[model samples]
Target: MIAYDNDNIAKVEQAYMLKTECLFKLKKKEEATKNNLLLAKYYLDFAEGIFQNDIQGALRCVNYYQKGIKLYRDNGEPQKAEIAHKRLVEIQKEIPQIMVPFSIELDIKGVVDNIKINMEGLTFEEGLIRLTQMFVFEKQEDIKNRVIGEFKDHPLAHMFGKRCT
Candidate 1:
């Protein structure tokens, strides 16, 4: 058995401060997407610490996560935004389900093989046709050109570039 500390408030504050310091250091790094993801996680952790005592504090933390999602999506980083959104969904489960004013509706299906889209609620038949036309039967040079022009420096870009060359 372990002893419990009565100074829980102090401990939470200390942890929050340490995370804030780490976030400040991360802001200076070049990985903007990674930095935002870490920032959201830290904020969520801090919010979880105070949720029982402070509803406002918990909501503030969720707001910070939403900002991270926006930043990621705006920077052409839908994968990172999806990550933040998933975290937000998990956190939201602890609170009431009332929809927030700034909620975003992302139709992403999966991240494997370059972020498969959900096809905007299309039926199975339509989706199959769209997939076949877009992926299965698309010409090689067209796919290569689109990937190279849009996904420069991406792993997919490098892989396709090698084949193109």
Candidate 2:
């Protein structure tokens, strides 16, 4: 049971987490559960503080929000858990899109938009990657190298097992 004060969010979070763990070990189930809830909310506050400075922190927020929701539910606070659960879903929805550069996203979308085949068994990413592969492999070596060079510093191609290099 650490009281939140002017201390930085991280310190407050650590204190609550340690207290929650200590309480559980002392056979203080009720106190542990309450502190667990506090620690969960602190996770949210910490993540939101990061998010305010950088929207890219949504990736980090996903983990914190998921932990918060679980802690809330396990502590008999399902109503509180639901709020965090919705935020988790929204963060998950935004993750795949957030890291991709605008130009790269447009390139992939251009391929996806003009596709002639039915990508019935594929995710949108799988289908786009298939097209990128076909386009890359069909080129003469010089052109192939040049096109891949464009994405050399970008991660989406490499992340999907297609090395742009």
- For each candidate, give its TM-score against the true structure: 0.31, 0.53
Candidate 1: regions farther than 4 A off: 1-53, 97-165
lDDT of 1 by residue, 40-155 (tens): 45444555565553457657657767765775676567886797789788777865543232333554434333325646578889877877666556689998998777766665
Candidate 2 whole-model C-alpha lDDT, 0 to 1: 0.72
The models' CA-based lDDT, in order, is 0.57, 0.72
Runs in model 2 deviating more than 4 A are: 1-10, 52-55, 95-156, 159-165
In Å, residue 127's CA in model 2 sits off its true spot by: 29
TM-score of 2: 0.53
Angstrom error of the Cα, residue 157, model 1: value is: 55
Which candidate achieves the best lDDT against the true structure?
2
Q: Give candidate 2's error at residue 57 in angstroms.
A: 1.1
- The alpha-carbon deviation from the true structure for residue 12 of candidate 1, after best TM-score superposition, in angstroms, is 19
